[model samples]
Target chain A: MRVRTESILPYSLLAPTLIFITLLIVVPIFQAFLLAFQTADGEFTLTQFEKMIADTSFADALKFTFLLLIFIVPAQVVLALVMALLIHTRFKGHTFFLYIYALPLAISDLAAGIVWLAIFTERGFLNSGLFQLGLLERPFLFLSYQNLPALFSTLIIAESWRATAIVMVILLAGLQVIPRDYFEAADVFGANTLKRTLFVVLPLLRPSLQNALIIRTIFAFQTFAVVLALAGRVIPVLTGEAYNWYALNRNANIAAAYSTLVLIFTVIATVVYFRLLRTSTAEAGFD
Target chain B: MAGIQFQSIRKIFGKTLAANDVSLEIKDGEFMVLLGPSGCGKTTLLRCLAGLERVDGGRVLIGARDVTELAPRDRKIAMVFQSYAVFPHLTVFDNIAFGLQMQSRPRDEIKRRVEDGARLLELSDYLARYPAQLSGGQRQRVAVARAIVMQAAVLLMDEPLSNLDALLRLQMRAELKRLHQEIKATTIYVTHDQVEALSLGDRIAVMQNGRIVQCDAPMNIYDYPANKFVGGFIGTPPMNFLPGVVRVNEGKPIAAVGESHIAPSVALASALIEKNGQPILLGIRPENLALASAQHANTIRARVLVVEPLGSHKLLTVQVGAEISKVSVAPDQRVAPNDDVWLHFDPEKIRWMDAATGDAIHPG
Candidate 1:
């Protein structure tokens, strides 16, 4: 029944974060749920849900978001792993490469979108450089509304370039902590590079891999700024659609409904990631 | 089994010479210990033999095959690292069987070999446990088991017991020696601990400054070190060196330390008579020096500084003129600080060395 000051001190220290999270994060989620379900007259209604289902761009938004996830996430994972390994080799200018790779992590998603937009836009640097090099006879409209595939590919490249660094940074940290002795031991036992990576490095890096995968997958489902910057209204992503519904059309109800859908998708994707990349408590660390 | 030969291998790291033209030949089935202090290139030389590091010069051979260009696996070798490096995620069974699996051995054969290795290292019960679940000694056994399970012609160990506690290090040292006996694989064990080298090595190669100073049987290396560094590096209290000049007193060849004439051993006496009036070093072990009841012909007066009672025996720190030396005596001997005593040297146990070069001056 006795409470000590030392025991209560840690809880007091954590009180601010707990209070802020409830007010800023938990309260808003509930607020979003209420706005999504209720009407302007304050009556419980399925009208917002009906409109969300019927809107033609709603299907396109879902398709575009899932398309981006399918192409972008795996590509980012592979590219990041290769980049991390290259840096891990510590050959000559590895520190320089690490700095360059992690440079994108400091840039916001919107800034990254605008930077890539400059490259892939019609008459942009990409087209001008290609034309100058004689690779293209004239400037190409790569991200035009007509060229859906090219637009999608450019968007994929931009997103992958911007996001892959996060995974690489995580994996590089993991790689650095893996003791050099493991690789040497594998070498002494006659394992080739591929076998060593698979049997030793990959297994030891499981916890970091799971972390990077879960974090990237959640961000993939909620991708918004880069798509809006590159293709504008041409690419109908779910988050872009939500923003348009709320800002341009002034319909907070339908926007909240769209947000709810994105929330559902991200939660499901995050759960799937957790299930797939599960690490046992023992495998999670080596202390 | 495979004999290893390092043909004047040179490994330079940045500006430092890690292995400077180091050449050593290890006979098949011999447990060779590369013993040295840190940064002495003992580990570097072993790594060169393992093909972990490319030699900037010379060649390496295992058995009859030139393995300098071969990969570690292709060289047919196994190594136990100082950190154990057992796969943290895998069970003991999987970690032991990893090399065999990489070589694509049959499932049953891999299982059998792993089981045999576990039995040998007494890790049969811990096969189901992960490395993180085991103690430090257990993890070391896992590393050893993994290495021996390969049945390679050559085995290399880099201070495998260095990470364990003192008691565990002693226990693991015995286990390694026992395992080497059961499987007579050519092993190159690297350690800075002289006790490990003396107890486990068939031959000890004492290294310093990236070169092998002496390579001989453990006792020989202890009794007759190649140089002062080797003499100082080995032994607990170490060999005591007395600076003196060879002189003929009345017809007897004796070594004059300052104003006192101490008789040299029979072998050292013969080696000294030819070169009279030449400076030489008399290297004698601490246990070889005893206290004399009175001043005798071969006795030197020493002032005791500290008398430390070490269980079964007593170690006396005594100053003989300009030289400070340790003398081990029986526990019952009555000696104290500031006690002046006459010390006697057993002539048969004395070793003579060149004062300038510090090399052994062998009897002709």
Candidate 2:
């Protein structure tokens, strides 16, 4: 068969992306797998995994990571859904509210972390405000290692404030595609607001919920910048342990093991989300 | 089960007046159709009745109870939307049972009602299917079934047939009439379609801008339209209108044409005698005017412009002086374009409209 110029043109156009992915992404991931399984002399061994399991913060990292994932994902999803629905109502000055809600999307994770850190630190705005309000005689240490739950909560709030906008945007798109007649039908059929939200709105929003869940969960699994900036070593996460192993201790193999574990968790999370928020092709707008 | 009254209803949407002091009474089991073109407030009026729209001022009564301040869910009304808003995620049975479930009815009663509704809508076989699995007509049936299962006091439909194809629309229109006959719910249906209004409405309420122009039975609305706008809006191959003068010729009231004049009957002359040489609009339906064999006292000369051969009849577009008029003629009528013709007025069928206000003036 003769290769047609038209077909050749398509592959030529695709070459740049294919080459870039193979070199930058595919090659690095392959090297990470190899490094995770190799010893210092480049010989294959299980020593990295053994070392990763033996590390003091490894179990803490996994537990805290799961804790953050369990708490933050639901908080962001609920918050974003509410914001999206409120915006969809098109009330007076809804555009202004939408703008305010999406403003944090442009913020870097580190920037958001630092910003929240200032508010949660001992002499930060929250403690200062509490002192001024006569609720506290002095600044309170809200981000101390003595209280892990407090530290965990600050991480969840800061992360949610930074990341919920993307999910809301996805949900807003989903909401817009839903015809206004459905809500009117619900009202006419005597479905109250809560019932309508539970039955009509949520069912229609499955594809978006699926997407938001997978993306946010994967982001939770891989997140390190915000965690480090806010909680540091006190609330050690998987990615932070990986970072500490690779950059501080100069151990790429152990870091690769931690990273490989993060990948596994992300894959598991994505699969779980796909199962939980499953939408038929019909509901996903295919038919 | 109950009647509806919109007592001096007024609704304002931002700067646009959607319903301007619209007051109407709909009897129990009466199928009242609010008929008008888009932006004429027909749908707005229906929404206000269904409690979907808030009236800035006025009261809405379902039977004797005032429901103007009620929420839509509390209004005891069910509606079928134009888009056939069947819950896409739900099975046909579940969709139909939604309202019954909302009412917290017994499970068995909900099942019985849904099954009955499905059978009524011919959706019994597709109870397990989702809306996406059904055709447009079937989905609309699901919407109808959903409404019917509730058995509310009032059933409001907002252009429900508008989304269907032409053949499906015709099919649904007949089915809706049949359903109304069987159920006898006090229904308020809104549409821009005149045929639906004429066929389905017990009383057709023709609206314009934000006011009801006329409300009457279908035939009465078609045969005796209250205004020129109502007449024109409700018919095809519309009423022929000529701007002419009512003059007294030989002491008899005659409408002056280009050079000739057509005199009214002896009965009509008595009514027009009071106002001589008054400018009036002479209106007649195409079917009411005939091609005269020769020029007579009741005939005006014209030239045939176009002869469109319809299956049942030939429609002749003729030029009368500077004005054009449509005349429905026998299909075998030997008339060609540019042929000279004389139009004979059916004196009894002529409608005289006020030249300025467009209101019907039944002279005699």
Candidate 3:
């Protein structure tokens, strides 16, 4: 059999990335598995798993993580799609709106959490504004443990505001790649704007939507700083619990166990999104 | 089918006059071709009629209604784009049925119309196939089928065959002409290819710089163009031009070329009589120039420069003073390069145009 240099050259070029991934990702995942299952004396043990299951906040963390995704993903998807469509309209000042819509993508998740922390503080803008407008008689305690709904609502809003921009940018790229003739053809065919968006834009935007959903869901499961900054342990999410176990309790084994749980949950959510949004190859004209 | 009337239609794009005071009336069921080179606003005028482009001035009437401000959907027109903008995601049947569905037609009616269109365009077998699975010719047929299935008041084709290969273009051109005859819909076709324009258009509207220079029957435009640009633009190998001054000899108008003088044809001579001492452009087609056996009244003595042998006929390039004129000779007629020949211009075939304005000096 003859070997070609062209075929082997690509693999050689990919060698550095393969090595880095093996060292940084593959080795760490293996070490995490070992740490979760074994004791410091190197004996196989179920001690960390028992502790993880018995932790008082474990069920709350898992449930709240899923709840956050349920709240944030749909809201962000709707907001991003609307923003993308507005930009696609190319009205006057659309460029200005495009820059403003994508501005939140530049802010880090920690910074975004801190930014919203200022808004939801007891004497922050919301409470002061409500009091000045006579909507309230006094400043409200928004992030208190007793105000769980307000705390959760504020977290959802902050996450949606900070993260929807990435999805909007993705959808905007997808919208721009669609040839203008399709829309013109639809118009000449007597399709109203709503029908055009439903039958033309959304179906064509399926791949981008799938990608955005999967990424957002995975990140939603790992949400930490925003919940921490706003609620201060009042809200328990998966990554927050993992941070508490490692940073506060100083237990590496339990932290690794929590991390594994987050990973598993992310993978499951990603799979569910794939199954729900999958475009059949035949329908996409691949066949 | 409905007729189209554009009264002083004007369109401006930024600083460019895309369609400038253009007026045309296309009869119902007539195939009118807007013919010009690129950037001459032929497509812009077609887009205006389709209501895709908003005219800055004047009125557009389709049938009896004014449609200048109406949306493209309300204009009751279907357009086939140059790129064959058939929806890629839809099957052939669904693509053909799209316009009807938009109109909220009954399901059975839509199905019957789509099936009929598929049969007409020979696309019945490919009804279930997506556009990506079809060949270029099939995709174009699907586009045409979609347009005709709408049964629009007018059909607009913007260089629909420009994307196909040579053989496919020829085949589709004939198919389109047949389709027009079968459907009998008023179609405004736009093309830059003179052959397509001349072959397909019942009336060819030649445009230049956003203005319709001449609109007339294809044969009339071919035989007697209204201006020098039309004359040079219409025919294959183009009409040959010779610069000459009009002079009187024995009370007759003679086109004087340096040391040689040929009397203008009677019809042309009358138009040139009053314009004596002014330069005129003498226009003749290549086929109109014949080999003169001996010295004749309207013959110019010249030397053959190059011989281009086509399959059926040979083209002889002859030098008449400083200008070179092509004369088509029969294949059997032996001719070689650099041979002295006396070429006679058919009297009735000569065209006299004003040199400055380029307009034909037609005899009253």
| Model 2 agreement with the true structure over B21-95: per-residue lDDT tens digits | 999999999999999989999989888887788899889999999999999999899999888889989989999
What TM-score does prediction 2 earn? 0.93
lDDT of 2: 0.90
Considering just the first chain, candidate 2 attains a TM-score of 0.92
Error of 3 at B204 (Å): 1.2
User: Residue-wise lDDT of candidate 1 within A111-207, one digit each (tens)?
Assistant: 9999998998878899999989999997788788998999999999999989999999999999999999888888888789899888888988887
Off by over 4 Å in 3: A1-34, A37-50, A269-279, A283-286
C-alpha positional error of residue B205 in candidate 1 after TM-score superposition, expressed in Å? 0.3
Q: Estimate each model's TM-score.
A: 0.91, 0.93, 0.93
The 10 consecutive residues of candidate 2 chain B with the worst lDDT sum are: B262-271
What order do you get sorting by lDDT, best first?
Answer: 2, 1, 3
- Quote the lDDT for A44 in model 2: 90
lDDT by residue (B1-364, candidate 1, tens digit) is 9899999999999999999999999999999999999999999999998888999998999999999998887989999998889988899999999899999999999999999999998999988878878888998999999999999999999999999999999988888899999999999999999999999999999999999999999999998888778888899899899889988866678888766777866666676787688888878888989998788877788899999999989999999989999999999999889999999987777777778888887776
| Stretch of 10 with least lDDT, candidate 3 chain A | A278-287
Question: Chain B TM per candidate, please?
Answer: 0.96, 0.96, 0.98
The C-alpha interface RMSD of every prediction is 2.8, 2.4, 1.6
